[model samples]
Target: MFEISPTEWTAILLSLRVAIIATLVATPFGIALAWLLARRNFWGKSILDAAVHLPLVLPPVVTGYLLLLTLGRRGMVGAWLAENLGIVFAFRWTGAALACGVMSFPLLVRPIRLSIEAIDRRLEQASSTLGAAPWQVFATVTLPLALPGILAGMVLGFAKAIGEFGATITFVSNIPGETQTISSAIYSLIQTPDGDSAAGRLVLISIVIAMGALIASEWFARRATQRLHGN
Candidate 1:
């Protein structure tokens, strides 16, 4: 195998950073959304679900373009943020994380929703009868019982963030050391001459990362399941 370059190393770090940011920020919202979808009956619920999952079905490039329009310097929230907080997302790593997070939200929500749905309602009722507040019941009972699916969802979101390309490149433009994640770096290398070596190295890294994510997800899932069931 060829020795990895500093550029590649930076890209690796950036990729991990983006994935971690996306997963951590999205996980809490994922759990909340999952709970809402699983336990609540409200008007336009189907529409809410579809809107949340839109990124999964829509073209990632299209999603990126939309972000550019809505989050660009002159765009609505973007303009306010720049004016008030002096922050920018256009061509920034934060923008890359936003794109990845939006794209991976559905993946994080799906498994969590399934787990929430699987929870036995009788347990929650019994907790309520025993004088546990709703928040207490959720924190102690529903959340604990649904931990396995939440873990799975987080892992899946991280994997998706690591592999995110289209929306990231569209929103962040693949600036080295800022937004040039592994997937974007690989794409950049593949477009030039004598780039095969670097591309190959990145490809291997991608596989390893993917496999590692799968292994981690399995580990968390099993551990959570065991903790919940104690069998």
Candidate 2:
């Protein structure tokens, strides 16, 4: 898309990878936390709820820095990972994915939690009454009921992760074909001389991708809800 270089395409591709990885990594935890927050009664639940949403309200740079400190090459967890698994996150694409994941988590959880809350607990109870175990009931009843919400959350999180800038950059420096994403590429173009033409191209592509994701999610969610209601 860029006028002078392959940077724009590389950035777009890397950004897509980061967003996909982040969404996949966050899905299980998002569903679990959403179920817990919506269905469980426990002490300090509000605190957990607030913590889940902390990323949404906090400065992205702050979150990125925290991730760096905790997961950087020499940081505690990072040290262990390096020593044990020979894996490192600092300035890596994986680190960028982590940053995007953290930043997008709140958006992922909120809608799923609301969906979980909307589920009829009675259906789960009925499943249990029919000799289904807790896990079985959740799998068969609760999860099916919550599909639409979960889909919405996933779509939202993926979109946010795709657009993540501050956290991604702060945690992982923009390295072309490594950690450089569309947002970072766009930012860089905006800073360079006569870069507006290329920037405009990338922006149009970004808008199309975003609109596509939104439309797909809307259709899927509606169809899921309709099927569940019919059942």
- Residue-pair clashes per prediction, in order, are 0, 0
Q: What is the C-alpha lDDT of each candidate?
A: 0.93, 0.88
Clashing pairs in 2: none
Candidate 2 per-residue lDDT over residues 1-231, each given as its tens digit: 336467777888888999999999999999999988988899999999999999999999999898888888878998899999999999899999999999999989988888887777777888999999989998888888788888888898999999999988998988888998999888988899997898888888889888988997788678667866776
Candidate 2 lDDT at 40 equals: 84
Model 1 Cα lDDT, one tens digit per residue, 78-153: 9999999999999999999999999999989998998888787999999999999999999989998998899899
Best by TM-score: 1
Question: Candidate 2, which segments miss by more than 4 Å at Cα?
Answer: 1-5
